[model samples]
Target: MNIFILEDDYHQQGRMENLLYQLQEKHALSVKRLEVYSKTELLLQAVQEKGSHQLFFLDIEIKGDPLRGLEAANSIRQRDSQALIVFVTTHSEFMPLTFRYQISALDYIDKPLDKENFEARVEAAVLYAQKQNRKTVADTAFSFKSKYQQFQIPYEDIYFLETSQISHHVILYTQTERIELFTSMNEVLKQESRLHKCHRSYALNPKNVVRIDKMERIAHFPNGMTCLIARTKMKETLAKMGGEIE
Candidate 1:
């Protein structure tokens, strides 16, 4: 997991960093990297370069910035909506203030940060992010990380997977966004060639499909949700499905 921290208080930053490491060891986490940023621009640039960050820890205040940490957290979400964000603040007054950042934030932790609360929340977030990090192919194999128990998936169960225009993670279509696991579209495409990349953003698994209404540029799955098929790749998509390229 990669996490970027935007905190100005040197002493508090040190404490948070220590807790992060401790959490890693205690949870047996596979944290590949963690970054600390004093500037929002630096953090934003890093996130953009990293493609996606596993988690973001933003302090609700910056020493000199006019906007609060909540504002910065919101900005980060605009770049990657699925990125896990946790806002920490001494201002417990912002508890019901939750709605302001509810759309982007996964959780808000109050200061003086309690170890028990921190551990529980971070553990839950870490587990959820890990779940969001991977998915199984439709069928014929049982593959998954040992620590996780998501179960072997049958590819026929997959609806579709697509890359987001503004983010690094690809969205999975398992009929529900809840099944929307976050993995690189590249890895997914390479592993399962049956999934036709009908557009720059979408790759559809034909097995779970209902019908393609080409005139409307949409794919209707058995569950009733529709996905757009870009006109640019219409020929290739049809060819993959064994239909004549019109």
Candidate 2:
């Protein structure tokens, strides 16, 4: 996980930096990078560039700056959905405003900082950020795009994918919904190796397979749907499920 410190006070900056050093030694965490920025613009730019799997320590009151830390957090959330944002401020009055912004902030620290509280919050945030970082690495997602809309679907959510018979169109099946996307099955298979090509027109998730009827040459999912499986590909499908043919 990476760390970004955005405090305007020189003394607070020094204190936070020291606390971070203590955290590193205490946890023995190998943080990929650390950045300290007093300027809001620089921090925002950095967040847009490498905000994934990152943690932020933002001071609520920046002297002479109208765009305070809360605004910066709102901006960061636009670019990064999973970043851990912690607000540090002198006044406790602004604490209630966090619910209004809905930034999903991790925690808030009162200035003239308490070492124990600071350490505890930082430790919790770091653990959560690192857990999310590992999930990002392991659970790769398929990104969908169109003229105006775009979203990502995690590979594990897909029960199966098949051609729609329309040019550049495919039908995606999940337990919750079916989506029509303008894409090729080859393109999708190339993106994720976990999908098994059971037939010329279909790819299946072995983990999602509830049953396979050899006589019908079909694979079943828990959603009460079945996809044709080529007779020749049965062995490979079984192998994917860690089953040995008897």
Candidate 3:
């Protein structure tokens, strides 16, 4: 997660930095980049080139301009509607303007910041950002065609694909469902690179695999489901998984 702070006060900036560092040390927050900008122009420039999963903490008043932070946040929302925005200011009266601007501010933190309240709001924002990241990943779908229908399943929900007993068909195993599709293993492989042929009968999604048993040559999924891993493919699969074998 990328975090951006727009605060003109030096003391407030130091306080936020300290609290964020403590959160990082305690493993309560995962931050890729932490940037502090006293100027709104610079902050907006960074927002224009922003990456995924961003969190912004803006002070409503910047250099006597009361509405500067709100304007900056509006620009951010225009660029990335999903980015998390939080207002940190003493001007509680301006809270209504957030709704008027349609910025969707995540939380409002009062200035002269309270340690306990600050930590709690920051932690909440971290959790929300993590959830949004998971949702984005889960939204990616694997598209394929069945005998009579076309299927699009979220990549995160899929466990594996195996050859069905019936000829020219394969069974797609998901977290809650199993779908029999008239597709070959070769064709399935072509659909998504994430689906690897771990065995002659099984093409498992390594991302959804909970564990790999080297001795048993089995792949365990989250839904108490299991699939075989071929001896010939075990070494290659282990390599792909960075040798995290049991």
Candidate 4:
């Protein structure tokens, strides 16, 4: 996971990096990017550009401005509600301000920087972030490996899958792209329950079906893309769709 530290003190900044590296060496944590920002604006800019779940360590005071860190935390919450935020400060009294600002901080670590306590809190935060990531991937993503590439796509983005003319290949269609997979419809169906085999060659996501034409035996999706629906399976498909046809 990405990690961001907002601290103006050069010594504390170095110490934080050293501890993170030590944690990595001990196999206690994994970091994709470790960045330190002395200013709140820089930190928020990075957050907006990165646009992913991250771990944040914010000092309660930046350049002697007492409320700067809390303001930064509030901005980060507005941008990414799932971010794990930990306050690193000597001002434990300011803890109550977190609730007032509605910043759902993950943890608070006091900053005379006790080595043992710091490591423990950092490790726990890393573990929590990893657990959250796994849960999100399991709930919303579809994973598959083809001969050329592996893909993990969000379920809502996928529109349909169809057998390709090439042997043992299937074409996966999404809102923005189409991919060829080295797999069969049976294997795909086993992985995702949202897809239903509407025809011999096509399995479509009922959620993405914008209109169904019983007369033409067609299922229409976004962008005017259409998939064939077998006459025999039409009744079953319609039933699965709660009989909502347009």
Candidate 5:
């Protein structure tokens, strides 16, 4: 749970850092907290360079541009839809304006901030982010981006994979979805060698495959899908999948 605080005031910066450290030490919290810049370039770098941040503590009002904080946040959300954004402001008036930026301002603490409310909100945000991480599909937690958004296709959901063109890819079939994963066959085999390379270009996830027809040189799955096993690679695939399954 990494937290990036984008507040410019020196005194307020110290206070936020202190609060974050206290929570992590006393609560056994998992966090990588930092105070980011008020400058636009620095703020942009803060949001882009990280793998994933659990929350953004943004001050609605900063020095140079009154709306720069919101601008930085908008950019951050474009890349990561899941990151939590909580505006720290000195007035309730900004509440109405927060929506214009399309941010899910979880719960902003108004100026003359209440100690109890501040603590409660931070605690809630941390717990919520942790919950979301736990709920994501575990079978294939690894994900990639599409034109619309990022999607994860679990390794277990892969019906079968194939390799070619000096690059490897997986033809992933899930309950109600079909996906093409951008990965190399060699990489997949290296990760899970249990996958049977039934052909020069195919790697079958045995769990989804129901049977192999040697006469037809094919593998049949319970879902009525079939894959041809090249004779050249049949012997190797057999040795890996075993002659029979229990």
Candidate 6:
């Protein structure tokens, strides 16, 4: 995993680097790269060019600059949605702003640092980064060509796939988007094992299913999207999901 730290203070930056080194030796973490930037603009530029899936340590206040770290993080998120951001700052008040920014931060570490607390949070962040990296490596995406562009749809991101109303096409429902492809349900099902035929027209991703309403024959997602489950397959589907009727 690549780790980036944005802190203007030299002493604080050194401390962070040392802590990272200590953690690496203690945990035997497989860190691929590490970069520390005193300038927010430089870090933002690098992230824009490199893309995310890296770990970041950002300071809320940079010398002579107001909220530069936060602004840089926002820009980073635009490029890398899965970037792990951990705020290392003296300003505890800025903690609430992470939710407002919707950056999906991993954790927050306060300044005037305690070694125990610093080590603990950073270790947690590294563990999270490793887990996310493993997921990306394991879950390969399904590649397809569209009229305008090619698409690579990851299996974990798919809630379900259905036979499109238009013949010879399939509709894939994800958490945030729906993609229509000129493909067959059998072709799509070959991409992943998590997907199963819940009905004649529908294939379900049990990982995305939060609840199964057996009586109503509906599989509910956390996003409030529901799909029909075949009555004959209800017991089988529930078994695959390891879930009971609600």
- The numbered model that scores best in lDDT is 4
Question: In terms of TM-score, how similar is model 3 to the real structure?
Answer: 0.55
lDDT of 1: 0.65
The reply for model 1, stretches above 4 Å from the true place, is: 49-53, 64-66, 95-98, 135-188, 192-194, 197-246
Query: Each model's C-alpha lDDT?
Result: 0.65, 0.76, 0.81, 0.81, 0.65, 0.77
Checking candidate 3 for backbone clashes, the offending pairs are: none
lDDT by residue for model 4 (63-176), tens: 889999999999988755557799998889999999999999999998776788887887777677767756755777665543444455667778889999998889999887
> Judged by TM-score relative to the true structure, which candidate is superior, 3 or 4?
4
| Best first by TM-score, ranked | 4, 1, 5, 2, 6, 3
TM-score of each: 0.58, 0.57, 0.55, 0.61, 0.57, 0.56
lDDT tens per residue, model 3, 1-246 = 678999999999998888777767776666667889999999988653322367899999999999999999999887665678989898999999999999999899887566787778877776777677656545676656434444555677789999999988899898877777777888878867888899999998888877899899999988799999999999887876677757
Candidate 2, 1-246: lDDT as tens digits:
678999988998988788777777787877756888888788987653223367898987776664488788888876556577988777678777777888888888777556777677767777777676667646665444444333355556678989997998878887776877667888777766778999988998888898888777888898799899898899888888788422
Better of 5 and 6 by lDDT: 6
Better of 1 and 3 by TM-score: 1
Cand. 4 Cα-lDDT: 0.81
lDDT of 5 at 68: 74
- Full-model lDDT, candidate 2: 0.76
Clash pairs detected, candidate 2 = none
Query: Which candidate number maximizes TM-score?
Result: 4
Worst 10 residues of 5 by lDDT: 141-150
Candidate 3: lDDT of 103?
A: 94
Clashes of 4: 0
Name the candidate, 1 or 2, with the larger TM-score value: 1
